[model samples]
Target chain A: MNLYEYEAKRIFEAGGIPVPPAVRITKPEELAKVHFGYPLTLKCQVMSGGRGKAGGIKFAKDLEEGKALAKDLLQLVIKGSKTESLLVEPMVSIAKELYLAVTLDRERGCPIFIASAEGGIEIESSHNVLTEPIPFPYHPYVGRNLAAKLGLKGAVMAKVADLANKLYKVFESKDLDLAEINPLVITKGDDVLALDGKIIINDDSIGRQPAFKGWMEAHLVDMSPRERRAKMTDLNLVELDGNIGILCNGAGLTMATMDMVKAFGGQPGNFLDAGGGSDQKKTLAALELVNENPAVDVILLNILGGITACDEVAGALVEFMKKYPERQMVVRLRGNNQDVAEKMLAASGLKLYPDLEEAVKEAVSRSKNATKKPALAAKA
Target chain B: MILVDKHTKVVVQGATGKMGAAHTKRMLDYGTNIVAGVTPGKGGEKIHNVPVFDTVMEAVKTTGATCSVIFVPPYLALDAGYEALDAGISLLVLITEGIPPQDTAKLAAAVKAKGAKLIGPNCPGIITPGQSLIGILPGSIFKSGPVGMVSKSGTLTYEIALALTESGYGQSTCVGTGGDPIKGLDYQEVLSMFEHDPATEVIVMIGEIGGNAEEEAAAFIKKNVKKPVIGYIAGQTAPPGKRMGHAGAIISGGKGTAESKLEAFKANGVRVAMTPGEVAKQVAEAIKQPAKA
Candidate 1:
């Protein structure tokens, strides 16, 4: 989960790190009230890297210019993610830009800090420094010594070390995947300030990070009905802007179904797993979860039986369709007790194919025909 | 009868529980000599005629079971694996999930140091058809034949096995290495095993999006594999950077994309199958073709 710049700055403030006074502006009325003087940097709130190179950021010299810049950035789309809000802050006159980030070093099985003297650009110049693996329980003495060795001294080195220590704490406690205070600026007055911030929290850590979770909940927008239902059921669901809605057991099958869908020339709307236990109610819930979405042109049920019996899933399908007669579904059921499930499906007037290729092709054809006919009378 | 011989003694950790008992029954039914069982508090108990010990060392001491199958919970999955490695167990199969990533790194390191191999923490375990069934995969789908199968997804093994059997090709051994993001045995490890196995003339490798495990396996195959290898990567259509099933099945910043995997396999001269049925058919055909030098 990527935190907005303002959110990341709030975390920095909590850690006692110095950041320029910033305001997250959304509405036009809030934009008018910006009391910051000329020479301000307005950055669009986005999750991707290379936002600076993109036109999503602008610098303005006056209030009128700032408002116009904010309006332009607010409407901009950076890396397919729209800029719904903007982070406004006064520009700092920097002597040099330094890069500092703490992320999980997968190879070392621990947290690591990557500090570089060259920053503010995507690609640092030749002779840019990237530190060796610095383990956690981050010692401020070690940080200060390293900075001094890198030619930074006096209060500048001490302040940078202090910030590094605090950042490490946040990185560990928050289970952040990536935390970057790019351009930890050395101002002319020798004060350190974070000019740009990026914080990517671990997805699994959402359970522990209540503040981040609350912020995400507050910023809820563009959630599909299937997403809402899956959220209610505590299922992981992502509605891709596609045609086929896939419901399968296990992640492997979910992935295979998505691939098979595409191989057959169909796009997958979302990936839905019924998990290990595929009971009647659970299967019905999964079907209803996908069926509730108007965007889903067809629902594909791919289940490979083991502990999850095929007959139980087949029974659930009958019950669900009987309750909702207008639903269209294609099922590819195999593995344990699959024979009985096939028999059941045949009785229900739905042809069951043992081959996934045939099943996917049929679903795609049905979805294509259903999409082509705009009028199931268009009347009512 | 396959992958393992009759002399390969097996141990089951957490054997007093339901899953352990079930797998024990299936393994026994498949003709494996179930040598010992281990449960922390349920020592001295006999489940399915196998003596249950309080520790893995005790089980190895009493029964000489060289391999261990672990059915412990997620929290203890890594520790259970480490226990097997420390006890000098050559092969360990873990069927648990939610094991911390750090723990996996530790287990992988421990296993490497001890010259031991671990199968899975959230995997379905390995099976040598007609010899032993250590995991939760159903026994009915398998038969003794030439195709050696390895997959990240547990149930996909069943799907591919069924497809092969229906196409008149039986498997020599099938292993589901699990679909967890941080896993033990990857496609490269299993492919090496299949490459040397006398019974395995052809290989079917199934992978999902995420990591370079599949691509890594392809490079290994190109350099070392003696048998023909056919590949099918799941989640070809999965949204980039969005985890499909396994936590690791994500395409991030140009890596682990399905097209990249497909291209890698093609470059390695491995037949790429777009679906499970095609995968089985391709493996059968490759086995019959003369190996290209």
Candidate 2:
């Protein structure tokens, strides 16, 4: 779960990390009453990196330019990340820049703190760090020792150590995979401020972390009735940008299916998992999600059933197609009750393939034909 | 004989519960000598003709069950593991999830200190072919064969086993190490055992995205093991830094990505399959390939 920059900053602020005062404005009108001083930096907060390089940041000489940049950013979308709001802050002219971040080092099976004297573009230069891997799941003494090497001392050093310890606690406690601060700038007065923050919480630990639970509860957004039905069934349904909508069970299989589509020279628009088990209603809901995607030219059903019976899924697919006749369907069945499901699918005049390799090939070929059929027939 | 021998009677913690009851019936159905179950406040209750006790020690003493399978919740899973460890159980299999990372580190330490072999915390327990059906995988998918199977995903274990069985390959033992980020037995640990097992001709590994377990396993496979091992990593196109529903399916930084794992395996000259169905064929071919002169 990747939090937007502002949300991550809020978490950092709560942990006593200093950040320049900032506000998120969705519209130019919202910046009308803004009282922040000159030399303001307007940044469009998108999830992807390279924001500065992507022209997502602007330095406005005056309030009018700042407001105009904010409005322009609000109207633009960069790399599919919406610029719904701009993070406005008083720009700090830095004397020196240091970059530091804390993330789970999966290879060592522990958290890691990556730090370098270089900051900004140097930090983003791909290979900034020149230190050996530090053992995380750290000892408190270890934290203090690392802090000392950073020239941190006195109450301030202690404070940074305390912050590191607390950050470790939050990383472990909240099941966060990442807690980063890029270009942790040093002001002319030698104050450390986290200029940008990023965090990716462990989704598995969402069950254990109350903070994430509370965030979800507080920010539960509205959805359409169809989406509401899909949500009620514990299935996450999102439309994709391509015409091939996939319905797969396991995460690995979903990716494998998506790759197979790409391997067969087809584009996959979305990834949807119906989980391990699905009754008829959940299957129907999943199909509805696929049909709702306008970019979807054909829906692919790929499932390796263990606890879930393929027969039941096939039955659901047949039933769903009866009501939603506008979309084409391709079903691939394997595992339990696969034979019966294939028989049913065959009888329904729907395309069914046993092998994933062959199935993806046919699905890709068919979708192309479907796309070109109207054009060719209109010419005739 | 695998990690746990046939003579080792087993007790299941959280017995008479949903998962415990289901596994108890299945294990007993498979002729495993499950002697006791532990469920707090449900002592004296019997699940699948196995006696239930409130404490692990009581079950161990009364039923002589030296092995325990745990199906406790996240908060109590660590305690359940500790309880089994304290009871002097030589082998413990945990199938619970959502345990705090710190708690898992502590539990792993304790298990090591007790010299007890732990299987999983979020895994689908372990199984000995034709001996015991101790885990949650459906029994119909497995048959006694010479191949040893170990995996991180529960669903993929069944899929791989089914493929092997269909290909006239039977598993000597199959284990799902679970997908929890902090788990007990990893791929390398399981691979080491498979290398020593005489009955095991080939080891089939199914790994998923997330941590560097696959990369570490590949290194171990390259350096130490002489046996032919074929593997298929799940989440080929998984986005970096995104968790793939499974607790352990997180691609942190640049590590744990399929591309990195693939590169490691390729660099090591390990035979890798593009799909789960390809695992059996590759393993069969690798087993027949003569060692480099």
Candidate 3:
């Protein structure tokens, strides 16, 4: 749900906030058409933070230098997220940098703005910040008070407050989880411009946020193939580097399964939530996704049938496990229609374990045995 | 116990749906006095022998139902919640998941404005063991005891409750705050309720990583809660920024980390349990020794 800087700036611009003149380009060859003057700023459009410090951003003095920098920025990778596009901007001469962000504070039970005169990542350690809890029917005075609290006055204060208001309108209108205008710079020419920005759309609100109704799957970044496949299948999956594949009906159970795997001296290959109602096809798809990991020594399917019928999951297990008869599969089915599932699995010549601890213990040991050779885990 | 007890009349929203109808039968079979159900168009019908009404207002008015548990689809959860709240249902437990957080936020704000209490929109609802079963939880797994429970997860709550029942530790009430980012009630509020309830001798809070709810609960326990609060956080192995099944189970920006939550709980007066089994064991130890304030 994190938007790249280019996308965020687009929203910021529509919200009436001033952003430095910029042109977005996907290819280095497109840099020739951009009319931004010398000393251009080339920023990689990646979701990862600290891209600037990671050399994802560079300065270009001319068209020749811009092409070179554009090529480098587009090819750069920061924290495993590859750069696919670049935001080419004319580096503005600024007198000061300020930090301003609006985010939901779960502890406070409302959205609040965190503003500071000092901007950039250094604000993490800076203490000179003012936190203004957003009042309902947001007034201009709230932003003005915040600007004044930061020791601002006159036309500069008025402009900064206006920036805060516009930024907040975008935040509230978009149902954003976070809207940040980091380094809201005061230019040498007495203009306030957003040098950089970040916006994270709330995942749940994507359905209402018209711009991203189906945006997640379309612009998925830093996702493995299996992950993308799972997304397309409407399954919740997070791939892990482990030996045992874990599939469960709920997030809590899946995570607890992973924790128990670690506790029992085994590692879980992935965290997959097959969802509340797991029928035959969904179960089969989930099994296939979990089994996609070649290093996965064993697959454990845990279903506490609160909203799901165990028989469907059991049916899928019986069929999928039969295909790979040599592969190790463990299942713990309880709750609704569990008795039926138990009978179905019994008829298929598949064993079913009722106890979670017993099932997990057996699966861990079986996975350990599948590898055959145990190597010492090196301490980093 | 701050939960719907035996005498509380309850209505099931989306009563004609598969999940609602199923849980209604289960709850009725467990002896819960479900007064009525509301399914919009499915009026004058009966679900598990409970009268069905067209709307929440009519259901509340006709049956005198003061509490409602919803199983409607995620998108319509807000309207369902508002209907229940506007109809004078003081306690609204939403069983549906995947409602937009902004909608939940607005629902929560309205719930507060109306002076009503709301539970999960993505949760399993609430259960007062041996008293009332107004949720999707299997009634047999829980028993009447002194332990009170609050969780951010549905299945994990079931797993731990089963573990507790097997270990001879029955529960007073187990409430799911739902795993969504914005829920009606949280650990801090639920903890304070448990602390004041004489029936609830010990409180068990199951938290997920993502938000600062656990940290806030830790601070609350440090100051207000006197009961022994046992905490177990799921998703210890969850990587940063990856949503671990639950929307609220992600660790973002080094905050809401398992390590940070565990540390916060330990630094405060709360006893932390690493796993589900350990949580049950911790409650046993907590009961034996009077918790030090």
TM-score for every candidate vs. truth?
Answer: 0.81, 0.83, 0.93
**RMSD list, candidates in order:** 4.8, 5.0, 3.9
Task: Kindly indicate the candidate among 2 and 3 with the higher DockQ.
Answer: 3
- What is residue B11's positional error in candidate 3, in angstroms? 2.5
| Model 1 docking category | acceptable
Tens digits of per-residue lDDT for model 2, A1-380: 67778888888888777888987888777776567778888888776677888889898888788778887877666766666478888889786676666765434444577766576754545574633244433577655765676776676566556656656665665667777777777777767788888887754456777777755432223333444445456665543456688888765567677767876788886767776657677877787776666567778888777656788898898888677655677777787678888888786787777666677777787678766222111111
Ranking, lDDT, top scorer first: 3, 1, 2
Error of 2 at A146 (Å): 1.2
Clashing pairs in 3: none
- For all candidates, state DockQ relative to the true structure: 0.39, 0.39, 0.66
Top candidate on lDDT is 3
lDDT of 1 by residue, B58-127 (tens): 8998888888988877657767887887787998888765565545655766777788777876788777
Tell me the lDDT of candidate 3. 0.86
lDDT on C-alpha atoms for all candidate structures: 0.77, 0.73, 0.86
Q: Give me the candidate number with maximum TM-score.
A: 3
Tens digit of lDDT per residue, candidate 2, span B1-293? 36865676989998887767876887788777788999988898888778899999899888778888888877788788888988889888887755665566667767877888888866777777778867676777788878888888776677678778888888899988877777677788889998899888777778877778788888898888887777788877665654565667767667678888887777765678888778888867866772511
True contacts kept of 1: 0.51
lDDT of candidate 3 over B114-185, digit per residue (tens): 999999878888889878998888787899888999999988999999989989999989998888877798
The positional error of residue B70 in candidate 1, measured at the CA in angstroms, is 3.8
